[model samples]
Target: MPRMLDVSNDVRAEIGDEEADRLLAGDNAPGAYDCTSCRTPGNTEQELTSTVLFVGQETAVLAFAHATCVPSQVVPVSEDQLRGAVRSITGEDTAPSYAPPVPAAAHAAAPHFPAPAAPPAYPAPAPSPASPATASHTSAPSSHAPVPQQAVLGVTSGVVLVGREACPALVVEPTAPIVRPGSPGHGDEFLQLLSEQGFAPVVDLSRPPAPNPGWSVLLAMGRLHAVLMPAPGGGRPVAWWQAHSPMPLSEGWRGAVGRTRKVLIYAAAAGTIGTQPREDQLRAALDRAAARGALVGASMPLAGT
Candidate 1:
């Protein structure tokens, strides 16, 4: 519809050049529709979008999504699934791999956190007119661990200075080697795993890391809650790393998050960074890790205020 949309070659081939051209001309497209991936409303006129065609044994349904969430493509569905999708009130399908555009509860004043299942929303705490705060948090209350192996993940919250800017940051390290699941080898795959999930090697502290789409940090009640990752098969997001109990954030760090609405998370293998009690010390450790290509990071958008 003369809207900014991406119709992949595969999708075009399946939908046919004539029908695809009709969609491109806006005759077969809607001005606004709910995103098939994140279930949020997107207007083709306002933002870049993708046209997803869901085909089944004997029928097909077209879906829309923000381009940032997923690229235009054809998703195969079962006949019963396609029929159920047509009967569904939302006209949405469940299996497309996608990232969210913006979380539904993203506008809360302070923070928003989601559980592994259904997450409850929380109101932001009252803001105090105090100076920006900084703190390093390691130990906390618990219910979950980062992995199923014998390892302790230490998460520290601190500020990383890039030139004159005090950027909010989180440091993750394990107390033991992290072995890959189902692998017989004992070699650590910590960075390898994170890299596979979209974290890139941090080359320079002077520049902020690129934002990793479909990945974000969840904070609630003014505290660190969990790091949310895309769902395994792509529906609601799930926690990639969660605190047993939410970790505390200082006024400064919290303020920094609220101001920028993004968190810079840096990770390294165990012993590469430990007992970084001060912000300066933490920054130094990060620099050292980056020097050796041991650091991986992403500037993730906050799911809440």
Candidate 2:
């Protein structure tokens, strides 16, 4: 059967003008599909769309996007990154990559940041009755100290249902399991760290915490770059977590952030959540966090690229 598609000059150059013409005439293009970049409904038969190519080491996938979301250009990404994007779109567990690697310099030049200065010190440990006079100096919590090595937060986006209503959600997973800064081989205390900073534990998604201003999600070049948190010592924003390769967020997500001026951010201390999960799995995680009162909800303004 003929396919309906909009072939950009760049794509045409790769696929050929004859094929491009055929696609325009619904001869070589696929019918309607989700825009790879924006995750919105797009049709080659109705509006101009870009044919995006994803190339990996041994596999490739052809994806579609709105011309506005991504101009006619080739995007070279890692195989894992490409798979993540596909999982977000298809609501599936696995996807193969197609775009070839871009210049090494392009990937290497992406911004990098050291972890924020140790959060305000944790409360001092309880004083020992036997050492009442030395308590002030001796009772300070050993856990308040900073870790020798820094950790990174890996941010992924997905949808969570609240009573059958799908809500745009951002999941934060730390590169290393988060434990108290000075507590090696200890239990994860990541959620506790956040709670100390005023991210009220989420007891229910239906009832989110009041909006907290000054925090925002930063996007650059129409991709997920970082989640900004208020500076430790009171200055400009600091990246709580950043991506080595910017991840593309769906258009619906962008719109949701703009319209709601809020986002549901959930964090797990020991492990991370996949972009794609069975509905039951998602709900189970939600129930677990709600049970522990560890989920965090905040109002984050949208900052676009």
- Which candidate number would show the highest lDDT if scored against the true structure? 1
Candidate 1 Cα misplacement greater than 4 A, ranges:
1-149
Off by over 4 Å in 2: 1-112, 118-154, 163-165, 182-185, 271-280
Tens digits of lDDT, candidate 2, 198-251: 566677766545555666665423345456667766755655554444455555
| lDDT for each candidate structure | 0.62, 0.51
TM-scores of the models, in the given order? Answer: 0.54, 0.49
lDDT of 1 by residue, 169-264 (tens): 988777676656556777778788788888899978988887888887865334565677776567645566655443557767865765566889
lDDT of 1: 0.62
Error (Å) of candidate 1 at residue 146 is 12
Model 1: colliding residue pairs: 1-26, 133-252, 141-245, 142-244, 143-244
RMSD in order of candidates = 13.1, 13.4
